[model samples]
Target: MPRSLAGFTGAGYDKGRPLLVQALWLTVSTVILGRWWCPNSVRVAMLRAFGAQIGPGVLVRHGVRIHWPWKLSIGADSWVGEDVWILNLEPVNIGANTCISQGVLLCTGSHDRRSPTFEFDNAPITVGSSVWIAARATVLRGVTIGDDATVGATALVTRDVLPGAVVLAPPSADMTSPTN
Candidate 1:
């Protein structure tokens, strides 16, 4: 089978929002929130105005890029650090008191490798309460970081992390035990 871009289609992909609204949000988010050095409160307010279910005391730092605000929900007192990109093609649910460190990428979209036309696939990402995703970590599609779990710096998470598990870099060793 020959691969072709012409055969590619996003028939299964739907943002569940109007085009005008999405465009407005994209413009505002890119030009204003993505570039400016605004305060966290202002950012939160802007996100809420665009239909994001942001809770109280959520701190969003500079250079944070949220792809779709309408599909995002952040719980109370969560801290999203600078340059954190939430590429939420699907819904992204963040629980209370979580810390998403700088340069983290929470992506909810991927391309199917088996498809000849490189079909798009999307899934939701869930980060439970008290979870900590360290700096520069990349959480891939359909991942669930459970409550109290700690994902170490630069770790690439491809699967569901168990509750209270500590995932180190390379993600090979299960650091759940005290002595490994």
Candidate 2:
């Protein structure tokens, strides 16, 4: 339910929460109803239809948001785990057979703190094939992980990682640069 803010209702966000059984049923039922319902498969299909460029048998679990479907691409046999948040304000590319763990936030947007006016920024996040992004990892914009790279749980990614490398450090935040 949306929160009542003065005379307006506000949208709620709980990206880390799993859908309860009743909530799951409600979500599936919406699929039968119409476009208002965002079933798991339906949402995936919608992403594909919007030119997400997904390969075969990709499963995007609930609570993942792809901001620009047209600019996002996922390779074959990838599993996007539960509550993984993707902000594709910029183009995002994921390689084949990759696993994106739960509660991972791939954010492509940021705000400039140096500027007097708060300006927004964004970048693409690219993950190579067979990579495992563990739970709660935050991949910032414009960072590319090479094939088979493992980003540990709760890790913050800031730079381009070499193939098969791993990092568990706080990410860098720069609001001036943005991705194409």
TM-score of each: 0.92, 0.70
- After TM-score superposition, what is the CA distance of residue 123 in candidate 1 from its true location, in Å? 0.9
List clashing residue pairs in candidate 2. none
Over 4 Å off, model 1:
171-180
Cα lDDT, model 1, residue 8: 91
Q: Once model 1 is optimally superposed onto the true structure by TM-score, how far is the C-alpha of residue 28 displaced, in angstroms?
A: 0.6
**How much is the lDDT of residue 180 in candidate 1?**
42
Candidate 1 weakest ten by summed lDDT: 171-180
lDDT per prediction? 0.92, 0.74
Error of 1 at 102 (Å): 0.2
Clash counts for all predictions: 0, 0
List, residue by residue over 1-180, the lDDT tens digit for candidate 1: 777778899769998689999999989888888765777778999999998999999999889999999999999999999999999999999999999999999999998877889899789999999999999999999999999999999999999999999998964565655674
Candidate 2, residue 156: lDDT: 87
